[model samples]
Target: GGGTGMIGDPGGKTAERVLLDAETVARNAEAIATQASTLFAGADFTLLNNADWLSQLNMIEFLREVGKHFTVNVLLQRDFIKDRVKDPEHGISYTEFSYALLQAYDYLHLHREYGCDLQIGGSDQWGNIVSGVDFIRRKTGNTVHAFTWPLLTDKAGKKFGKSESGAIWLDPAKTSPFAFYQFWLNAEDESLGEYLLKMTMLSKTEIGAALELHKRDPKERHGQQLLAREATTLVHGAEEAAKAEQVSQVLFGEGTLEGLDADALQMLKAGAPSREIQTGTGIVDALVVARLASSKREARQFLADESVLLNGDPITDPSETLGSDDFYNGLALLKRGKRNICVLILK
Candidate 1:
């Protein structure tokens, strides 16, 4: 249920990554536990650190015990090792070559301490998992079971958890719930059926209904809606999901700024693309900086035509400087006329 020494699993023929600093790894471990708390709330889970035992092993003792079982010939036969060592651009490093032994020791230590009978990981981890099982059997005379799920992939065979923007991070600060929802909402039709079944805990009947609806009318976006709702609720909870849904409805639907609370309005603006301004900047300067208008002359013309809105209301004066009062709950809502909106959060 948890990872030990995350020397960063080698997969997809990737170059060896710089190992995490002790402090950074500690922080990452804590953060992962926090995120998992919501999903595995009632499950029996234990977070462990391999360094607890790994750091204590003397070099002579380690070689006599754990290292004796592994041979260089067998090690080089691993797909990751063979591919990386052969690749001209990214030859495998010695530290990465030793990764398997380190990982196997983690399993051995866990078995000795907790009597952990099973290890599970992605299908790609079969070699590593088997290595751990074999090490345990050879050293301790105990049988252990290991299972791995097939790597979750889309119809095109690309991994499911990434997007054009980047990895879909579990941290809200890294990727907002709205953006996260949008990512799933935009899943290709071909992938929706498999994705819903694999990723969500929804029952078979509910998943089947969503899939049927998607097939009947793709434009109705039943799959997208269900994906967004379930994912958002899982990550941010029902309350935050409801708030994000309301915001999306107002921004993309027929609703206006009047429908939003001050805090919600501020969040909306923060989510949008924006530019910051000094305290003394005039409305004209702010408009130009935000690119709502192309030039100062165009900005003035727009202002004169009553085509500029601050917080969704028309502004008639070009000379008006952005004042503290213009900000709704500490965020300035800017719009060219009433349609194109940008939010400015005062620093």
Candidate 2:
């Protein structure tokens, strides 16, 4: 994705891409390399950046070597290309139009250099992929195979990563492990089976069994839980997955906050409402501050009803105070009933 990242892939776009600067492309390439290395750990593979060759090509030489094989008529016949060409406001750019040739050259280069014979990508890349296959056959007269799977889409038919919220990045900095785990955990029931089958490394037998179990009680979300756990473990590692799961359980009242540290509690900031308050804040005031109760009167009523729990202990006394002992590692888990929860971070 080195050179290709600069000119974004126009597979499913309605408009031309804003080209990236060289530095941004390099940074993105490095990030992608790191993620690929982490995800494909223990697999036998060599990572190669197409920029290694693409960046060194002479225009005239490349036109003679590769461009001549591709025809405008064939390129325009592609669905994406055709769509772009039909658009009056945002016609395709020559840079993007030439992507197929570059990709075709990539396949040829890999086949010649690394003896790589197979190219795989999403169904969106079928046109570009076949272009590569045709290029290789023409250049070296050697046959190569290509395969593509259907694009992963949610229930709304939008591609998985292109959500309205924004792209779900693999980088932990861009999207936290907890957020990433939650994204899968909140997957729609209709899409759960496809997500489990495609996203995780679970076998068919295991998936079938899980689906069967999930069918008995969809409310339990056994399938989603499994998918979330497996997907999070694959991307962020087992420890991070465990941490995310722990935070999730504590938030849902299925687990305790006993072992949760500041890091684990931090994950709750996204799932549960939180506020900062000094230690020794009155229980009534704390509940109000947490938005679990509308006012001091409401807070007191909740406390009087024995519905409020401070660190999982029912607090019936409105006069009770939250002190340093109430906080675990600068964080306190406050619960009102089973559904509503809030975190108080000591200021």
Candidate 3:
């Protein structure tokens, strides 16, 4: 089944959401369905609109069936509602207050139509799932099961699947497959063992073997690579995963500028820290602009040490002005010391 795209559930102490426009909700629903199809290929699925039934219900009928079962005292006592309502900065809204009832009615509708018995969600959703179950029991005298997986977190106690940039989105346009792979590949050594087994559908024995290899040589990043490959392949498909790996190797490994085209070069450049240099600016000025070195003095020091690369060639002359010819077919490669490389595409 597809997601309901609910506007704002009264489950958290957050600001009232700007409800999505009809067109925006439609687009989001389509994207969600596409992602779900990838994860659950060949499975029977139904995309239902809660508004279909919800809008049709009159006040009297809703009060008689669903609303009668819920008590104001009990609803007010719910931790989520209490906390949200108590918060001065982000007080709850009336629309949000009725969110639980709408969700419960959704469950009742689905159960009556499809005979759906189980609901699964993240640990944070336990309260909502149980509320649905309670509504079904009260209305139809039927028992329903609900299950939740504990929310995953990293070793540092931060939420999983998020980075400094933002959420690791499933859409390739939002987040490239290369970036997705790199995220998993760079997972911490401490959490690698448990994360590999839990996050992906890899067999337990395979996971154990990968863990053993990881312990044997942590620097090799065996487990991390596997996690990246498996997860990326699952989400973006095998072919895209292979390309992502290739791009990663060329950028991070011994592979150099010759292997990358203009597009690939641009993608690689995006991964590195970068700065802009105006046309005809000198290499020293470019270095200063990039903040690769603190000042002109340090820029000179780096140049003297043969630490700067212009289009993959070391320039000993600090005074050398960057010309159109210095660019690699159209892009200028900038490097500080040797480990960090960025590309400057002429705009």
Q: Candidates' TM-scores?
A: 0.76, 0.92, 0.80
Write one digit per residue (lDDT tens) for candidate 2, span 1-109. Answer: 7876767778778888878999999998998889999999999989989888888889998899998998899888888889999999998999888988888888888
Candidate 3 lDDT, 1-347, residue by residue in tens: 22245454546546676776767776776777778888677788876666677667787987888889998787898888888778898887877877778778878888998888988888877877888999999888999988998777778777654334356878888888888888898899988877787668899999999999989999888998899998888888887777677667665554556667666666677766666566788778788777777798888899999988775567879879978776655666677865666666665
What overall lDDT, based on C-alpha atoms, would model 3 receive against the true structure?
A: 0.76
Per-prediction RMSD in angstroms?
Answer: 5.0, 2.1, 3.9
> What's the best-to-worst order under TM-score?
2, 3, 1
**Which is better, 1 or 3, measured by lDDT?**
3
Q: Superpose all Cα atoms of candidate 1 onto the true structure and report the RMSD in Å to 1 decimal.
A: 5.0
| Residue runs of model 3 more than 4 Å from their true location after superposition | 1-6, 42-44, 88-91, 160-165, 260-266, 273-291, 294-297, 303-333, 337-339, 344-347
Q: Estimate candidate 1's alpha-carbon lDDT, on a 0 to 1 scale.
A: 0.75
> How do the residues 59-133 of candidate 1 rate in per-residue lDDT, one tens digit apiece?
798778888998999988987788888899989876677767777888888888998888888888888888889
Model 2: pairs clashing at backbone N, Cα or C within 3 Å:
none
